[model samples]
Target: MYRAGIDLGGTNIKAGIVDEQQHIIAEASVPTNVERPYQDIIRDMAELVKTLLKQKGIGETQLKSIGIGSPGTIDAVHGVVLYSNNFGWENVPLTEQLRQYFSCPIAVSNDANCAALGEVKAGAARHAKNAILLTLGTGVGGGIILDGKVFEGAHAGGAELGHTSLICGGEPCTCGRKGCVEAYVSATALIRDAKRAAQQYPESSLNAMCEGDLSHMNGKIPFDAAQDGDTAAEKVVNDYICYLGETITNFVNIFRPDIVLLSGGICNQGKKLTEPLETYIQDKCFGGSKAFIPKVACAVLGNKAGIIGAANLISGKER
Candidate 1:
């Protein structure tokens, strides 16, 4: 009747108790605390699970399973965190370690895949058989749902859509790739572009907002300025829209998915982000008629999608 979901993020460990209908019944949190030793971080997760379960009046026997959406590369079948940049984890069997405390079946997947699965099961992609869920946060993350299933490539690392080349040798990405979408259209890029805009237009208000703190700049700087009709802001967000549009247009040309869900805090810029992206997508996708484009919209579940989706990983599996 219930399942446990954990979104193990860089900043926080979010655990939720989800009903069979995919609604969150109760939730708990713990800091990921990457600076802490490895065992302590694992203890954080294990302790949170017990805390939520005990307070929610749910016993281990009532839980169908547990699902974890973890950062970095993972071996889901073996429950290993192969290598993760966030927690400095290497070949750590998280599920096996956590199960030592919970004694319940556990499913694990990359965070992006879990987000995509979450969208497919209960969020934006619910009605579609094939879709892509793209979350534009500090960086870009992607998940592919094909015929009602997460399409894991041979190594369970399929759909690195963000790293897909948009321009050859354009911008260097942390992933060691040049011209990846994240390099051009992520919140990182947005902030970088904002700073450049502020330099060129010293009179702009953006300079005052962040007080010149580059890290304080985010995807919203340009978006907020654009709302006020500032030409400098328009330039940054427009360029962002064009490159971002180009990225998804490529997906349409390849997969022709029925839906493409927009997500992340940056995406909430609303029509300012979506409208231009839709226009650019229509112009670039080669296969479709001029009149039609893939349905593109925001992800419905917000942050909870990850927690709810993590619970759905064992859709056809048992406790």
Candidate 2:
């Protein structure tokens, strides 16, 4: 049987029909336009699923389940998005709303967790029963998988690894917390540090790369400058890596998963990012020599991970 996976984002709603092999056979997307009422968005999601099924010439009986990867704090047990700052949503019964249009076992989970599940099932760490994925995008998002299952904790509100504190009274975070891992390890954080460095060292190549516009500075600017042998850019890149290394070390020491995967734009750095991070984690993790040390790598699934993982939520079980 196949399953429908919906990746609900503030900008778009992506849905796909994923086969048991975890391949997307039919897929489509629609603008979320979250400014509209929540009901409209839910309706659009159902319609997208229907379109995918029709394109594949499949019927309801051929679909095993529907899974959604939604942002914010999700009460997966009830398929409710408790709160999502991105959507300004609160207490939306997403699963119940979708059921009105599609009759299938529905499951909803935090988008980051779904990405981790996707990686476990078909991407990086596919062979590992325990894995952790960190997505360094606008903010750092994390998903923890244990024993081949997503661990949502007791309230289905845990696994928020980004919010874990990294510094005391350091950079302020959008979450109203100071020195969060997200504040240091996210692409936002990298850009912030890069811009500051460029301003302080006007001679740095990063200034020219960003066209002297601080607002134009991005996560790649510093890395590009560092490759050109700019000391200031190198400092920014090194500092970002140091903070990320510390965060990964903390997670490794605590969970000891089989692998720690890094996702999002930072992964584009390839060995430049992963090599140092792997070294730092190895040097810092407790009992690294005697115990199993988790390997660090870049996640391969990219954007499709959430959709594929969400579709496989039922794991071949029938409703």
Candidate 3:
């Protein structure tokens, strides 16, 4: 049987059709235009699904279910988006509205969880039964997969790895918390560090990369400067790795998953990022490499992870 996966984002709504093997057979997307009413967005989502089915010549009777990966605090059991700062949404009955257009079972969960699930099913952690996925983007979002299933905990609000405290009272976080892992390990955090480093070392190449405008610096500036052997950029990159190492080690001690998958633009650093991260995690993890060491690697699926993972949620079937 086929299933439909919808990835709802502030900028776009992406949908895909997946077969039993978890391969996307067909897909489509549209601009979200979130300024419009929520109902208009939902209607567009329904229309997107119908358009895909029609393009593939597949009947609704042939599909098994529909799954959605949304941002913010999702009430998965009720298919409601409790809140989404990205869309300025709260208490939206997303699934109930979609039901008016289709009759199949529908499941909804946080987009981060969906991305993790996708990695477990068909990406970097495809071979592992228990794994964790960290997406180091504007924020450090993550999800945990235990025994080949997404672990949402009570209220479907667990596994919010980014929000966990990294420092007792460090930088403020968008979540209204102090010193969250996201405050240090995310791309935003990296940019913040780079800007500070530029101020401290006026001779550094990072200043030129950002045209001396700290506001223009991004996550890549520091890494690029570090590659040129700039001491200031090196320090920024090292400090970022240190916090990430601490967070990964925490997960290793707690979950002991078979593998840890890293995603997002940060992963583009490739070995420059993963090599040192692996070394740091190896030294800091609870048990040494002698006993059940978990491999840390970059996620292979990229953007497709959310859609594919959402589809997997409907059946809870692992490849």
Candidate 4:
């Protein structure tokens, strides 16, 4: 049997057909029409799926299930997006809508959780029965996979690890909370902090690179600056890593997962960011137990972990 995994983003709606081995047999993607309203976007996604079917010579009857990796607070069990600031959705029954097109079971989870499951099933955390995947993007996103399954929690809203508080009454967070890990470690936060620092250290290469418009910075600002040993950018990145390390240390202390896979554009810098994080985690983790060190690694799947993980859910024998 074949399974389908769909990743819906504001920029792109990506999907792929997977076989039992979790290999991509066929795939489809299209730019999301965020300005065209919500229904139109859904239709566009559905059309993409149909396009995949026509190319792959598969019918709805050949598929076992479909899973959608959504971008916001989702009621996975009920297939409803409780809210999505990204997609402009509020309590929309996404899975139900898709079910009308395909009779197979449909499942949905936040993109981060999907990434976690993806890592556990087929990526960097493939050897781990319990692990977490952190997605560092414009904002930070995370998912926890325990016992080889995603523990979505009572409200299915748990494991917002990035949003978990680290600094109280500190920087403002998009969630209206103060000093969330996302607030401290996200790309936005990194650039914001770097800009503030650049104002004082105006001669730094980072300041020069952005032509003093630090607000327009990207991940490359800190990454490139650090590569060339810019003091301001190095300090900014170091501070960000410290915040991330402390937050993750708490997770290691509480859950003792076997692995924590870092997945994001910033993680692309690899050891430049991870070495410091590992050192800090080793120094600050709650347990003196040397045996409790979770293998911190970068995500192997890049962007496909979610699509592959979602497909894995429906890969076995059909019901």
Candidate 5:
């Protein structure tokens, strides 16, 4: 039997047909074109899945289940998207709509959680029964997997690791909170701090790297300049590491999972990013060196994690 996974995003709707072995046998995608009506988006999603199955010459009955990774608050038990800022969607009957096209068990979950599940089923955390994944992109998004199953809390809005407060009342977050982990650990936050550093010291190499235009600065500029021994850039890089380190430490103290994975552009820094964080978590976590310190690594599946994980929503079982 095969399962279908759909990754619904603001820009695109992606679908895949995966075999029992967890490998994607076929895939299809369509531009979400968020400007259209919700019905249109759903139609596109349904069509994409149909196209993939057709391309593989697989019958509809061959698909044992279909899973969707949707953004925002999800009522997974009911297959509804409670809210999605990206599409201005609220209380959307996602699974109900899809069932009109495909007759199978459909599961809808937070995209972040699906990503975590994907990593566990086939990616970096495959060997670990419990793991955490933090994606530090435009905003910080994360998922918690406990005992080989996604933990959705009582309300299905749980495990929003990014929105958790990192500072009591520091930077404002997009979620209307003050000093969320997203406010400090996201790539946007890192770039914001880099631009500020560039403006503060006109003589800094960062200023030269961005060519005196702060808009040109990105998450990589600081790390690159720091490696070249630029004091201003080093300070910015160190500060980012400190904030991220402390944040991971706090999570470690709470979950103490088998491993913690970091995703997003900043992870491109490789060990330059994970090494320091490992050292910090080891030093500051509750048990210090005597306790089990989760290994920190970068997410390997990249964009595919969402699709693979979504499919596992039904096929996956708790260990």
Candidate 6:
């Protein structure tokens, strides 16, 4: 039976038809146009799905199920978006609305959870029965998998790992909290620190790399300068690693999952990123000698992960 996955983002609505092997054989996308009404967006989403089936020369009856990955606190069991700050949405009856077009089974889940499930099903965490994923982009997004199943806890509102406290009374977070993991460990946080370092050390390579224009600074600048033996950049990079390492250590000590997967553009740093995180985890995780150290790896599926994972939700226990 064929399954379809829809990745609903504020900027885009992406959908794909997947085979039993978890491969997306047909796919398409459309602009989300958030300025329009929610029903209009949902209409575009349904049209995208129909477009995919038509591309594959299949009828709606041939589609077994559909899954939607949306950004927000999702009530997966009920297929409702409890809340979504990204789209200023609340209590949206997602499945009920989508069911107007398809009678097949449909599931809704948080986008991050879908991505994590995608990794476990067909990507980097394929070999792991339990894993944790952190996408360090504009903000930190997290997903947890246990026993090869996505875990969202009660009401599907759990596993908001990014909002977990990392430092007390430290930097402000978008979540309106102080010193959350997202506040310090995200790519946004990295750039914030890089900009500060550039301003403080005008002679540093980081400053010159950005041509003294703080607005030009980004997450990659520090790592690039550090590689060229820039002291200020090295320190910034090291500190960022420490914060991330500590965050991973906390997860290791708590969940002890088989692996920890890193996602987003920051993972492009390759070994330069995972190595330091591994070293820090090995040294700082609880149980100095006998604890299980989860493998640190990059997510294999890039943007496709959300789509694949969302589709997998049709068969997921949480769904």
Tell me which residue pairs clash in candidate 6. Answer: none
> Which stretches in model 3 have alpha-carbon errors above 4 Å?
317-319
Off by over 4 Å in 6: none
Mark the 10 consecutive residues where model 3 has the least summed lDDT. 310-319
Model 1, position 284, has a per-residue lDDT of: 76
* Cα RMSD for predicted model 1: 2.4
Model 4 clashing-pair count: 0
TM-score of each: 0.92, 0.97, 0.97, 0.93, 0.97, 0.97
For each candidate in the order shown, give its overall lDDT on alpha carbons. 0.81, 0.90, 0.88, 0.80, 0.90, 0.90
Candidate 2 local Cα displacement, residue 79, angstroms? 0.8
Model 3 clash count equals 0
Report per-prediction Cα RMSD to one decimal.
2.4, 1.7, 1.7, 2.4, 1.2, 1.2
Model 6 is weakest, by summed lDDT over 10 consecutive residues, at 310-319
Residue-level lDDT tens digits of model 1 in 1-319: 7988899998999999999788888998877888887778878887888888899888889988888998888787787888988788889888888877876789888788788878877888888878888878888888777777666565755677888898879889879979898898777877888989988888777776678665677777777877788888888887888888888888888888888888988867776667777777877789547534787888878878888878877772221
Q: Put down candidate 5 lDDT per residue, 1-319, tens digits, no spaces.
A: 8999999998999999988877899988889998898888998898998999999999999999999999999998898999999899989999999889989899998988898999998899999988999989999888888888888777768888999989969999999989999999999999999989988889889999988788999999999999999999999999999999999998899999999999898889999999999998899999788988999989888878899999989856333
34-121, model 3: which lDDT tens digit per residue? 8889999999999999999999999999989998999988888888999999899999999999999999998888898899888888
Error of 5 at 31 (Å): 0.6
Ranking by lDDT: 5, 6, 2, 3, 1, 4
Candidate 4 per-residue lDDT over residues 92-209, each given as its tens digit = 8888888778888888888888888887777788888899777878888888777887766668577788888889788898999998888888878877888887887878888888
